[model samples]
Target: MTESILVVEDEVRIARLLQIELECEGYRVSIAGSGHQGLELYQEQQPDLLLLDVMLPGFSGIELLRRIRAGDADTPVLLLTAKSSVEDKVSGLDLGANDYITKPFQIEELLARVRAALRLASGRKKVETDSWLRADDLELNEATREVMRAGRTIELTPREFDLLVFLLKNKRQVLNREQIMTAVWGYDYYGDTNVVDVYIRYVRKKLTQDNQEELIHTVRGIGYVLKDSL
Candidate 1:
């Protein structure tokens, strides 16, 4: 099946260029001129991947990403912006963006990143066919991408889900930031290792909600470990 891609860019020329390039690569592509239109098309099309620009009319791309993640965290979102500061990158990634590319980027690099995101999504779907991972009272059904803790459902973003699974698979073993990043986000990821700490916090927050016991323990000066009894 040809993967569908949605380009949510406020710039007309850039949007058209992206659409043409993606279509030439055998992907079904759609373009939106503003954040509102992007959101509407996103719901209607349910594209396999989203190419979102940060600056936009009405709501910003970051805001759109937040809203998308609130309800659907499985889709891959790649952010495009002129802001190349470390803070900007961290902000987007923290909001559940799968990847970030600044303006004045090479088309080759953009295509490569897009391919990487889609490939990761494909790999995840393949792994989700018939597998279950568990740690303590937390159970994750990869097939359904559903997580349950103490008989209650727990929602998580794709990255968070991947991180938890990695930790669960290595239960009782301390995994450093580099190890976790490679296993969960792939070796090609070129972001700050602190992203690992951020995601760990996210997982811990969701898992320990409502005064539940914590299964993830931070190892001082090392990394983290998941154990039934910490």
Candidate 2:
């Protein structure tokens, strides 16, 4: 069966264009004009992939992605943003978007990104795993993207989870800010320190709460390191 793709875009022209292009590529395509409608279709159709616009009328794409990831992690979401800022890209990727594309992008690049995301989601692409990493109560299952703390499930945004997993994998190894950015955000990052800072703050706030000893330690003027003793 052909993989089904759902395009959630508020702009009529973009939606129509994507429908035509994707259908021509011989894949099933569906379109929703708003987050509400997109989510409704998602529950009903359960499309194999989602093409979500960052800006929406009723609900923001980031909010929608959060909701979707809360329920399902297997579904691949490609976030399309008009803003090309590094912060925006980092935010989208942090929120669980498999791929991020700024608007006015080349059609070929968009399609390639889509295919790569799908391939990764579908297990067609190989991903290196770090076996397992443990830091105090937090345990990271790198291969499965599962995180647990003291036997309690710790819900994390995709980027937050990735950041934590990466840190844990290289536990005790001080990873500089640039290294973290390059590893988590890929080489596309254009020297955005705020992206790293913002995400690290988010990770620290969300993952370590209720007086839990923080596992992610920040070395002054350096970067971050994950240590169980911290």
Candidate 3:
């Protein structure tokens, strides 16, 4: 699944910068300009991660954090605060923020922390859901990250595994490249490369190894669809 992030920032330029950066990293990003809108988006979207600014127009980030933590203590929230004082950090942390970064910090550092937070969230999610996703003879174990097709174990790279999971979850549906890229790769390709096609070929090659039947079919001028014909 694609990780969604809601960024609550009153600064237009900063919000746009964050949307672009996070989307490029394959995360679905939403921007909210005030605490009210942030709260609305938070309840509606339930994003996987949140990047909240400490200062806002309607309500303070601290108050927003408090409101969110009242109902949700699980979603990872990282505060973007200009204050470097320990008290300020502690305040947000007390309100249940996973971490905070002082403003005017490097984007690289923020991105790294975002990755860490999402990983932590993903880990927690593993034990809560059924471990297996299946279609016909193919099976994917979410916990073990294992894939097996027609009694043959197939090893896949991490990205390939994510793509396969997305495909399996939406089996029998015709999925376009943009949707596939956003869901699997977590970003829009913008014609930057034929990554979707390349990865499809990679997966097909492995799935059809040893004369196994092909499960992924092309829709010609459209996109690809996964439907087991067995």
- The candidate maximizing lDDT is 1
> What tens-digit string does per-residue lDDT give for candidate 1 at 147-230?
999899999999898898889889999988899999998989999999999999999999998998889999988899999954
Please give each candidate's TM-score.
0.59, 0.54, 0.56
| Backbone Cα, N, C clashes tallied per candidate | 0, 0, 1
Per TM-score, the best of the predicted structures is 1
RMSD of each: 12.9, 13.3, 16.2
- Candidate 1 vs candidate 3: the lDDT winner is 1
* lDDT score for residue 29 of model 1: 97
Please list all clashing residue pairs in model 3, or write none if there are none.
26-186
**lDDT for every model?**
0.91, 0.84, 0.90
lDDT for 175 (candidate 3): 91
Evaluation by TM-score, superior candidate among 1 and 2: 1
lDDT of 2 by residue, 1-230 (tens): 79899999999998898899888877799999998999899999999899999888899888889999999877899988876567767887897888888887787897888888788876732342444578888877767667778887878899898888788778899999989998899988786677898999998887777778888888999988888863
Which of the two, 2 or 3, has more lDDT?
3
lDDT of 3 by residue, 85-111 (tens): 677688999989999989887889999
In angstroms, what RMSD does candidate 3 have relative to the true structure? 16.2
Candidate ranking under lDDT, highest first, comes to 1, 3, 2
